[model samples]
Target chain A: MTVVMKMKDIFDCKLLMVDDEPELRKMVNEILRREGFVKIISASNCNEARQIFIHEKPDGVILDVSLPDGDGFSLLSEIRTTSAVPVLFLSARDEDENRLLGLGLGADDYITKPFLPRELTLRLRAVLSRAYFPVILKRTEKPIFRLGKTKIDLNSGAVITKNDQLMLTAKEFALLEKLYENRGNIVTGDSLCRAAWSDNLYGYENTLMVHIRRLREKIEPEPSTPRYLLTVRGLGYKLTGVEDR
Target chain B: MKNLMKILTRYVLSAAGVALILLVVNFAALITWTTQSGKTVRKNYDIAQIADSLLRSDGGYTLPETARNKIETNRQWAMLIDNNSGTVIWSLNQPSEVPQSYTVSDVAGFTRWYLNGYPVTVWKHPDGLFVLGNEKDSVWKYCVTEPMAIMDNAGVWIIIILILNSLVAVLLALLFGLRLFRSLKPLAKGIEDMAEKRPVELSTCGLLGDLAAGINDTSAQLKRQEAALSKRDNARTTWIAGISHDIRTPLSIVMGYSNQLEEDAELPQSKREQAGIIRRQSERIKTLVSDLSLASKLEYDMQPIRRSEIALAALLRQTAVDFLNSGLSDSYDLDVIIKEDAQNAMISGDEELLRRAVSNLIANCIQHNPNGCAIKVTLEKTLGNCSLTVSDNGVGFKQEMLDDLNHPKNSARLENHGLGLTIVRQIIKAHGGITKFYNLAEGGCTVVLSLP
Candidate 1:
């Protein structure tokens, strides 16, 4: 709890809380206020909520799933278009479908309703911590693997080589790293489900397969014959050649 | 038409009932009239002569030869007998065999007689003795029959005619009664069916067609309202999904930039502090927006249930463990009692949705109850359904609030009241199931749910 609060105290941005229930809004406000929040705003409905968002320019917003005039989704859309503020949905709508939908709609985090104030605070800190402290950028000097003149920096995200000419999309990089990270773990078709869809892993194996194939075409030395990555019989694909075996 | 036939039959039966009552009344009147007129018959049949003779000193009285011959040739034999010894003193048909005397009191007791094909009356003389006679066989038999005798027979015929007339009156009353009811039945049926909110089955009976038509109009209006409500519900659901998608785009950018800022390594402590602020506030915004989306989803349509065979007992136990592991179980004491042999109670429903339903029930218990309050969850299997009940010793709802929930027809605006129970209702309904909310007499609320 202290670690989460420590991370949250570093961020000095405006916070907006929207819920129809006054008690809940007050409870959340008290918790965030004690954490050294610089500015805070609250609204009971979407109509008033939109005005608050426009005037306050909050960096983060806490919203109830249900509102009187409209809902948090519409308000999220309006705020997202004109401003860059991460929306974290705190709702009593705890169904998996709801959570999946919220995440799919670019929600940073989904907290079920009747949540503990401290739990929400912790989640808020974790999310805020991710945004404030950048992952350590490992410096890689070894160039063990090369594909399409793209020398793979296995330790760091850097794709560098002797020629120093490489281009790839974020999706492509994520796919490649995912395959290499499970070098010997035999990452099954089901294991990569949540990372992409953030939902149930049923009947989505083909979609993951397509993403993997697309990643290989971009990085493989020869598109038709992959040297570094190998598919195990009747199981799943694995990354080879880490020890040059 | 079958309806017309029904009306006709009812009228006939009613008429028959009335006619039956009249027949009884007429019979009583006929018997009374016959009894009173019987005395008149006795007086005309030589009853006056008998009284005059008894008044004289001697019993024997010599009549004219013509009168004697008439008496002797009489077809109905006459006998005067001694009441004490059964001795005959005078006889018309056989003087040797019949008794000669009869007690005057005994002679006056005759009540009935049959003459020819028609029934005759036997009269007891009010003054003297008995007289039993039919229409006389004489030249002026009609004239010989004293005017009183003629009157007695005529009176009998007239009373019989009166009885018959009363029977006709009853039949007419019954017929009219049937007609009146027939006309009102359709209207009555329409009113009854209207109360039930169903289409009236009665085709308009005459005089009630307008009433039936009115009821049909109201039913049509109700249908229109139902259609409009259905359309609105559909539009609202679609709008929620659309709005959720719209909000996601900018949210991604805000989150992306916040992530980038936090990851910058070369930044000084002051900038990093600023970056931290940016990231935390961005997250708070995301929470608020997602909460709004969830609110809209609840407001619109509940997510459809996808059914599959699942063991409910296992699912409930797993959910309990999940809640406990999530740290809510410790804050609020949880007591779980699954019925013995509850295993193999497989149900067909959306597993995730069912889980959500159970989770909401448990969450409500935890939320409403004070810290350290015991929350009880029980699972039982009944015929053709599995039931799960969640109860807590929390502040229960009032009766009026329960009434409002039971009957939502009041168009109550419970939108902002909270969606935990409302969503529970919607999900249960989608599963073709139901939920019951009851406040225990001691304390708190218990929600019982049943699934097929």
Candidate 2:
């Protein structure tokens, strides 16, 4: 069982960023500040980073691969000796070998330089949340969803409307669960078939359409002109989130 | 090895031809010598006709004046012996030391061989035996005789000897041919190895020693050139990597600051829009730098491909979905249609690179059409190969760009399309696939990527 975490708790976590460039460190500091991260400490080299990391005991770390005094991989190994703190590598090396090496050395994520500010903040937040507040990330795995007035209980394969209850077959439940997972985003017919039939969408194209129709009839207010369950023509289908309508 | 056999065959044929020419020359010389010697002997006179000219008269045997004159002018002698008396009945110009009479055994001996020291010719006449003698040491005569049975089988003997001679000639040819083949085999192999870029070292100690040495030198020179070329390529790749790496930090700073300013609510709308443009251009620069580095790495085979089995249908669907979900505008629409047969089409490739290739094609369509376009990506399995087609209904490709793509060696105008399409071609080529680009007649372009 996992509990939901408040946004304030995420902003309260401490983050340590280590890079060789001072300007990059300052820019990242500013970016994090704007993203509502209250605690962020920085170091310019490996020695300073090690000192800060040992004394400050930060909840997460963002490290660069190259530094003046030493490289980040060895520093990561050194840090791993005493702690399980989430470490994300931010470096200019975008080669696959470097990415694999960083991840192979127990990094939580590898983000190349010149990245979008939002992407960096989001990755940093995810790493921190995974490390200190994993229960909050797991809370969204609940097996229940609401589509308009119809309520879906995935665990029991039941659709409860205002006055009556309906049941979904195993295949229908699988398809609904896949669509619900990517709610408000397009879920391709191929992906849905793989989820529902545990096979490809070759011979199951019409079978998938029939199942989607039955699923919409159970979950939507108007089955013919569906509001929640929708089709993105030539692509696949999209299920709207509960708050969309 | 095939060349070795050709050389051996030529050597054998030449050797046989030389032997045959020698045999024909010797036969021709023998015939000429025999005919000339016969003509010289005939120029002297027909010795047997002298007896016919000797006519008997009332006086002692009278010789014809012509015959007497011929025998005397030739510095020769003539005589006749009586069969009853066994004595010389008539003689003319006979040497004084020569016997004028002969017994039966003596006559037989002189007729077959010689009279004393003189070589003579004898002919039988109705009157007696006639003899003609030449000067000593002027001619040589010998008698040859064979049994009838041996003479009768001479044709068979000549044919047998001819066959035996031919067999020996062929045998000798084969022996010399094999020796020549031994000397040349290694050199032929060396040349072949050099052609294939393999190191070659041949022994320089035979009839073909100079040629072998030349081949070895060429191979060594090629090896040196190859090493130098690889070194240059390595330097180029490293330079690109260094430049791209060095630019990343400053670019990150610029992008970060510009993004912050663009989202700042206190700024004026126009100012924020200007900041947004700056951020977007900076993002474009970031893409350019990465693409430049990737293109270099791929060109030099420096990028390691991580291969895995990929279902192309699912991959295409996921790519289209990601684009749509990432906020593709209403003006532009993207669609993915996977053929039923292609839904199970699987390939072994680097998933990331292939995904990037697909993404580049779609991005190409979006980049070319600012006013919006409809992009359709389709996947199908044809003849055991996976064929992916990305077509767009928009401003089609420029004719120059299509020409540049068709002839990649002169791809000077590839910069107009950016490195996106070029990198796509490189990635697909690396995976042993072909990329084709053409404009649709309906005012758009289509790119077909076929992977085996």
Say which candidate scores most in lDDT: 2
lDDT tens per residue, model 1, A1-245 = 33334444445757788887776676677667766675778888998888887787666788766687876777777777786566778754435344546355656776754344456777877665555443442233323455445577644545565655455556556656666665544444434554456533345656767777776665666757877666543235566555421
lDDT at position B277, candidate 2? 98
TM-score of chain A for candidate 2? 0.81
DockQ of each: 0.03, 0.64
> What DockQ would candidate 2 receive versus the native complex?
0.64
Judged by DockQ cut-offs, is candidate 1 incorrect, acceptable, medium or high?
A: incorrect
Residue B129 shift from truth in candidate 1, angstroms: 19
lDDT of 2 at A205: 76
Per-structure clash totals for the candidates: 45, 0
Q: Estimate each model's TM-score.
A: 0.41, 0.93
- Which 10 consecutive positions of candidate 1 chain A have the poorest summed lDDT? A134-143
Candidate 1 local distance difference test against the native: 0.61
Backbone clashes, candidate 2: 0
Model 2: per-residue Cα lDDT over A1-245, one tens digit each: 12124334667778899998988989888889988987899999999999999899887899998899988889999999998889988878667345555357888887888888998988988887787677755765557777867888876889999999999999988888898788889998889988988877767878988999998888888899999888987668998866422
lDDT of 1 at A64: 69
